[model samples]
Target chain A: MGQEMSKIEEAKNLTQNQILEELEEQLRVEEIEEQPDTIKTEEMVINFGPQHPSAHGVFRALFHVNGEIVTKIEPMIGYLHRCFEKIAENRTYAQFVPFTDRMDYVSSMHNNWAYVLTVEKLAGIQVPERAEYIRVIVGELQRIASHLLFLSTAGLEAGAVTPLQYYFDERERILNLFEKVCGARLTYNYMKIGGVRADLPDGWLEETLSFVNRLKKTIVDYDRLLLGNYIFKKRMKGAGKISAETALAQGLTGPPLRSTGVAYDVRKSDPYSVYPRMDFEMVVRFQGDNYDRVVIRSEEIKQSLRIIEQAIEQIPDGPILAPGLPKDIRPPVGEAFGHIESSRGDLGYFIVSDGSLKPYRLKIQGPSFANLQGFPAMAEGSYFADVVLTLGTLDPVFGEVDR
Target chain B: MLTSGQLLEFANTNGIPIWVLDASIALLLSLAVFAICGLGVIVLVYMERKVAADFQLRWGPMHVGWRGTLQLIADAIKLISKEDIFPKNADPWIFRLAPTVMFLAAFVGLMVIPIGPKLVVQDLNIGLIYALAIPSIGVAGIIMAGFGSYNKYAMLGSMRSAAQMVSYEVPRALSIIGVVMIAGSAKLSAIVNAQSVWYVFLQPIGFVVFLVASLAEINRVPFDLPETESELVNGYHTEYSGMRFMFFLFAEYIAMMAASALTVVLFLGGWHGPGPAYLAPLWFLIKVFAVIYVMMWVRWTLPRFRIDQVMDLGWKVLLPLALLNILITGIIMLL
Candidate 1:
């Protein structure tokens, strides 16, 4: 039994990159021996994106293909860059909240919360209990909305059109809820430095509770519609596999890291907002392949619903915004970092204050940027179709990736 | 009721020259086939959109002529009016010829189908083999489009289509063999006449194998790797435009009709429903549309399989099942 345990441990310790290297070496030696000069094949380098469908946005990659198999991948980014950080330097701390919304525009609420959390930490502002609870509720709702987009796009990349339409119905409802709360759907600048922009409107809590309850039932239908499908599972099962160490080393967070069984969520490891008070399991899967990465997001949506339900029940009646704050408030000369578990991954904002109204230097550590680093590694030596599937599973929003 | 032989005899009675009569009859038959297939393509396109919309939870093409009935006509006009573009480095002759070859290949397959009693263009003795063999010619057109386009995505799409079509032809042919053995003829009309009980009942496994392999053969979803929109953009026809692009679209829907019609003849007892002889074509069309509807339903509901997985299913699973189906049919015949 001890010998078997050690053997299992050794197998688990084998890095994915090492295995890929060994396989490539074997393939290389075989190809060198078998090839004849008369029938030699040349590798074709094809540009996969920048204007392609299923790119999610204006993301580009060069794929070197031998027949249908991809031998190498080179990712090109920054086409959607809008000089967000540079613009942040010119604006006041309060004025910068709206700028963060455009970073990861799909889940703008989470971006809003992450930026505000950094500012709150830097300015030493205290948020009321009710505001934290409201933040948690909206943040969890944004997570669900973001994940719904991911699932729909993933379905589309796999060539299933019905799931995209079906999942969008649910995402539209979530967006409607956001539109009601913040008066803007796509870029909700609802979070302030110390609290939320406003309290729940009449019957808002009941409506949110109803939405979660309805989603909990429909998500099962979604699982049956897309996730439980035979062809979908076959497409995803062993494709684009990465090991736990490789995932962590690539700085992957959220579902991508959790898929490798790392169990490292920013909300759980370092508690934020009302997350510590909420009872929910950190969703994890062990395969770390495209399938697990997708499945983990569905599981996380369930957990997010759990968190929202708990927050709504525990919310206290208090102030929405902090009292006695200056209109153009300045922070002391110091640096502060705040991270949140956004829909895609760990979204963090780092601020360097110089006792001025505007930030001296502001940096956004976007999870999409970091998660995309692992894509080429996973995509190498995969089939051309699997490369697209792997990119869909990674779910990098280009707004964040090129921010 | 007007067979080609009756028309030729009528021309002979009128003292018309045989050669001129033959030429005119050939022209007339070609025009009739073209007209029927053209009308069929428009209806199939509209039906495909409506069916896809129904599955996708939206109103599809509602503004066009009463729930998108005239949408395809509008599309046809648009396609006809568009500029025909040839890429700078494209091989003009091959690029120009590809869509025609593809359209003709699919078009000719419909000539052999027995829509009603004595209604076929030419009920040749080798009709079954001809229908199967002719559509494979479309692969050549696909390869030509890919090679002549000077585009990498088109090249990849064409290569994938060639590989997929070639691989699927085996199981498709094998699956049909069980029905051919029981029917005792390769002529499509004879085969349909042999089905007192539909072949789908006795050859259930063969029916399934034929359905799946034919789906792959026609390049429907779940097996649509050649023109995977997300992965390959527009695939082989990426650079095709104007009437040339319309040819590819027309060929696809016609090919879909041909496949579904062939499925009806082989399995569902074509033109054999309880009805008058005048209504036989209607019954045949109803069966054809039913099968086409199922194909569209599957297309919307399922995601595509990766190329390797598709090849695996074709070779490892369906091939063996098809062979076993033949084996079982032969054993029962011996008993």
Candidate 2:
């Protein structure tokens, strides 16, 4: 082994002890050679991709893998760089909802609502009671759809093809509902500035209720298929574990954070959009591993159902959209960062208005971005397969992560 | 020319043309077995999807012909027309031959397998040994594809597979030995005949050990560490594209089916049915599909094991259990 090491070192033009030092020097040089001369690691970097299938979009993970477990990851951005924030800045408050559809295309309706809710909060706009209830129902349903995707994609990347279609079979129904409500399927820009774009389609409530009813049985089936699976347990349990403190320090929110035993849900901790009035338990689990992340999502889907059920019952007989909010009205020159508990994590919008028709600047605080910060920490010293599972459990949508 | 042992004189009395069987008849028989095995792979894949749907609470592949029964046929067509790309620097000969060798090795193993009463391709007296031996030929295909592709990841993958398959074979064969001893025949039909009661009930530990090791042998998860994507990037066939990739996939699914059938034959009883002997192969088919379904379920349900853990499972858990089964079986046979 020593002879082999020496031979490798000789090939690299270095001694055994000099190898680490030379590597560090190379890293420093690579960092300094950047366009702006920024310091960075140059440690045998491999570009995970701009068009790679596994990167899950035009996402690139610049990895410094010492063997299998990545030692450093400088995630390069600006691939699916659609300039969404810039587009949002120029569009009217109502027009901006469509652009929000571009944010996370998997659960576009939830992104639409998150943006609209932020704008509504800024303008002191009170949506009709029915709209609030309708919003929660749609949002929760979108949460299930989003997490289902996370679960399936995670499974697919991990070599589990059956679950992707199994989850997609149910997902197709939800997309059908979205298509019925709005003319679009993937990007439902249905949530307007003040409320929803229109009232729920006739029998939409009944259809949603039926879906909710079936989803209960479906969750049970998911548990039977996956929860008690010995392989699933072995793969996920104690893999990619993050302490509650580590999660909080990294600004991780939503299920990933909650899975670490921190019950800080935006719905429960800082309620918005009639969530305070809605009755639902804040689903949580203690072990901050990939298994816990998965289970938390499972529980959250059930909780989302509970909330949706209540929202359907409590929906008032009134207009879905408020009548008075102007289509182009802009807020005064001030900055407001509105954060919401999106299905992935804490999705937020930071708006800087110049007291004009359009805001001067807008920033999207995609939860997936912050959630990715926990990845390197979780991945270090883990097996190659576990890295895939960990990333899957983190549920980082490259759209949000790169945005 | 018949070598008879105690209670084996029936073979000489039957005067079967055990040697030099007609080439055309043998070819026809081999072709028939091949067809059955191919059909079994297709049906198993579809049934696996359906079972997965049942587990995941949804409908699966319902849009194709007649509740998606022809989905596999459609998939086969799609695979046929696909362009098979050879990598720029890949070894042309080996790359082209890899999938064929893999499929051939697995397919040939089917010949020795006893399907039903008097319905075997060639019931070699060394049928059990032949059944175990043919699959190890697949290791050459894996290594050839891995090295021939000249992809670093594929090389690593094939290397890991070479090590894993060889290591796991020890326990896999040992586990089956318990049943072979009890049956007292290397002939597959005789083994099936001996299973008046399934070895699964009598040799439960052996059954479990064999099942685990067989999964490792087929490179299914939690033993799918060789193809760990996050590590070696699609393992051995990373450079293989289009139809070549499909061929690799075909081999994998076929191997999954074949391994499951072998497990059924060895432990679950090959063709002993509740009804007539002619229905035995159907029973065997059902058992094999059930095993395949469980394999798929496991693939979706669990994560891949680390190479070290996989090695440990093969040596530490399975090997010991297999040895224990042998020891106990020996003691019981002595008593």
Candidate 3:
């Protein structure tokens, strides 16, 4: 019985090795078979996305994976091809604000303002002083909200869900204010061609004051939860270090550009909408890394809060919307590109009016779309984990990228 | 001879009723602590949410109880009612046993915690040591769940957690040595009593080391490598579901509570009186919450570390520093 058991054990060992050898041979044969097809093709082709989770959206990065490295990334878009620009061409200026919501849904207000600001410039309409101030406040608040969402989701991709919940909770408060102001929460069509849709509510000032005051403690909490964390530092620091030269070449702006040590904020550089009087500094970071991106967001939130506080203090007692304008808005035949510092980057809207109520053409220069262009360039030699971190720091809004 | 028989008969009759009553009370109080653990787990989760919300510049649970106080109630309801699922290929007993093992570990750790003066469930002389030993048992549960799942990611996560816990254990234990040497006792009450000025000011280095190590051991933030979403997904508990999943979650929060309580006992002076005896536990809880808040901040602010870096920091930096802290404490004590 003992001799038979020993023989059976030996046979089992032999069978295990045989199975291992067979599996190895199968893998080698599969590799051998798969390589020739790609090698024979003079044009080496690889599809990087569409189905890939890290493409930021339905955007595809068709590329050649040389070993573990990405050789090239060809961005294949139109998966979310609603042709928002074309849709805007047929709609009146007032009607187009809703469509603007589709472009960068994270910061829909920025898009709305950009479109309206362009039309307001073409029509040569002067917005009320209080309305302009309120617009700045709302726009700045939305920018903070959008950036916080970016921070949260980016952190989520890095396996940090607590911060995501924290940020969304804060974002919900801003959304509540939006709902109170415009009667719409996520997609607020508050901005009209000439001015805002409605006047500020009765307790709007008091509510805004309380929100501003409470903002600091929450910021401290976020700091405790994330900023001061060692792991967060390890993951973020030196992870995606882009230089100012590369960023400039890529036409990067807003947080990404600022992260590369540039101090160019649209509010400071161009001073559109009553930003000239606003007391806010351009938040900049020097490392040009993921850490810098996070710091830039943090600093920007502070500046945004500052702007909101100032707006509340200086808001003149006047009509919320500019009066004495034609109900059916029309601007003369002209074209203008209005740019705003959206949460992701610089959001631009080029409007071509044909002296009609509707535009002849509307071209949206989505910052997230442009910002996503450089992802493959950055992701070449990095690990898969870094790819997630890098993509997070870029803060891509699929709505903007796809639109 | 008649008098001796009468005395023996009288003593036996009285002793039985007193012993029975004491036994019943002890059992009832143990039951109460067990009940409190259930409530404590729910509150800890809600508190984390509220704290996180406050940090992000928002109100957390306004829709639930007064300011969303009842949010945990809703969450508990959701978790309890959810379907408990086990994979077809999983080891049936281990899969069922893993969460229970984790829960049991947490519950045992709570036995050593002295919430207030004489309010302990068990005032064992080895209470502090018992608290320290219980968390390591959860590692086994993690490994069991990982192995039983038949998922590569879960297995990898389990391996990662084992390494992380082992590495973190050194600094965590060594940091405690400073307080241990100063108190001259392993008893938690003695440790708290020794800290009249609070160990925070005296052994600030030890405090910092303990905080970092505890955070790592609890698997928060930069140390949360085992379950990194971009890497290992949901870590060791990937296949867990329903009440089992909740059990794992409860264990994590309980671990958090345990770590916080340890911090209070060692550095912040646990249940020491700034107020009346009844209010002292509240103060202890507040200190623990503060530590938890700091943990949250560290999580949000910092990025995660690679496994190698985590181990290197633990073995090379924290271990040596913690040892030095203990040595210096010893020298100071001798003088």
DockQ of each: 0.78, 0.33, 0.30
In candidate 3, how many Å is residue B4 off? 25
Kindly state the number of residue pairs that clash in model 1. 0
Candidate 1 residue-wise lDDT, A232-338, digit = tens: 99888999999999998999988898999998989889998878888999999999999999999899899999998988888888798888888997999999999
Over B1-335, each residue of candidate 2 has an lDDT whose tens digit, in order, gives: 22335224553567645343345557877788777777777887788778777766678889889989999889878877877767789899998898888888877877877778777777899898898889878988999999898776687688889989999999989998999899999898899889999989989998898888888888887778667775566789888776777777777777787788788888888888788766887898788878887888776566566666778888898899899999999999999
Kindly list the per-residue Cα lDDT of model 1 for residues B171-274, writing each as its tens digit: 99999999999999999999999999999999999999999998998899988888998989989999999999999998998899999999999999998899
CAPRI grade of model 2: acceptable
Clashing pairs in 1: none
lDDT string for model 3 (B1-335, tens) is: 23535645665776655566558767887688778777777777777777766755566778987878888888778888998877989999988888888777866787777777776777778777788788878888888888888775577678788899888887888888888777888888777777888998888889988888988888887788767765455778888877888888888887887888888888887878666777987988788788877877766555577676788889999998899998888888889
Clashing pairs in 2: A27-A42, A31-A40, A231-B302, A232-B302
Q: Quick one: best lDDT, which candidate?
A: 1
- Candidate 2, residues A151-255: lDDT per residue as tens digits? 777666655566677778788888898888888888888888778877889999999999999988987876666655665676678989999999999988788
Question: lDDT (CA) for every model shown?
Answer: 0.92, 0.80, 0.79
